[model samples]
Target: MALKYSNKINKIRTFALSLIFIGIAIMYVGIFFKQSMIVMSLLMIIGCLATLSSAAVYAWIGLLSTKAVQVTCPNCSKVTKMLGRVDACMYCREPLTLDPNLEGKEFNENYNRKKQPVNKEN
Candidate 1:
């Protein structure tokens, strides 16, 4: 079966969530090395860094969300946020686009990177 893509924000949120879990797991594993203070400290530090990085990712997503266009998904009839010229519905995974030229065409992520009259420099 082919893989399904999720909304960019949702994907990033999932990643951050996973990182929190991974950090906790690493800290738990460190308990096994109680005899080695240096190893235990290193493991704890790594775990803390993972969680801190996850927090940063969450903050970044929040900033991106402000720039995302809010639209009602026709497929699901629900309000959702889109990040670029094209995106998928967060609820139904239905493809959506803001460009009139792209309507009725196959959804391609490259459409976001395609050169256009408007400048959207990062």
Candidate 2:
């Protein structure tokens, strides 16, 4: 089975979008407890918080996106933003990299992690 790759920015945006729906679902469930004001109110408050947090996440990723490097995907020719050493094209899911050394290497999310030197003594 082939593993699918996705753009990091797009993934985060999808997650934030899901949060809005989840919050709405929570609020909808609260309707069943209409007889109990406290339960209904508590659910409503939690739902609002979830929705608001999603907005915050959107804002944060938006800011970070502005700082990401924009590059044309060699495979699709469409411009896409990338973060860290390796990322996938937003439009085509093509693997992309800013580092020349990592070019042509198998795409791995682990490439983004900082490499730590091995402690031979240990």
Candidate 3:
């Protein structure tokens, strides 16, 4: 069975890239409405906003890159950045975790969430 998980950073990067393309597509569509100045301008404005937001997302990813831990992926032996507690190798898609206790366990995104209290006998 193949794991479907992808590196969080890579996923966000893909989203950012898509946003740029979508913005450009929207702007292109605006050209079709040359006769309607109001509609064309509105589309252009929306497209510009989308492009600007994508830029902001890129900036956010830059900040996140600084916080992500850089480690050599054991599976592929390539350098990859990991965010949160669990992430996949950017190149190999091998699941990774920083927590020792969770090592060798099935990869789950929930591991990155806040842990709930476990009931125990005193």
| Model 1 bad stretches (over 4 Å) | 1-3, 114-122
Model 2 misplaced regions, further than 4 Å: 115-122
Q: Model 3: C-alpha RMSD to truth?
A: 3.0
Give TM per candidate. Answer: 0.86, 0.90, 0.89
Tens digit per residue, CA lDDT, model 3, 32-114: 99999999999999999989999999999999999999999998899999999999999999999999988887798888878
Q: What is the C-alpha RMSD of each candidate to the true structure, in Å?
A: 5.1, 3.0, 3.0
Error of 3 at 43 (Å): 0.5
Error of 1 at 56 (Å): 0.6
lDDT of 1 by residue, 16-91 (tens): 9999999988998889999999999999999999999999999999999999999999978999999988888899
Q: Please report, in order, the local distance difference test score of every candidate based on alpha carbons.
A: 0.88, 0.91, 0.91
Best by lDDT: 2
Of 2 and 3, the candidate ahead on lDDT is 2
| lDDT of predicted model 1 | 0.88
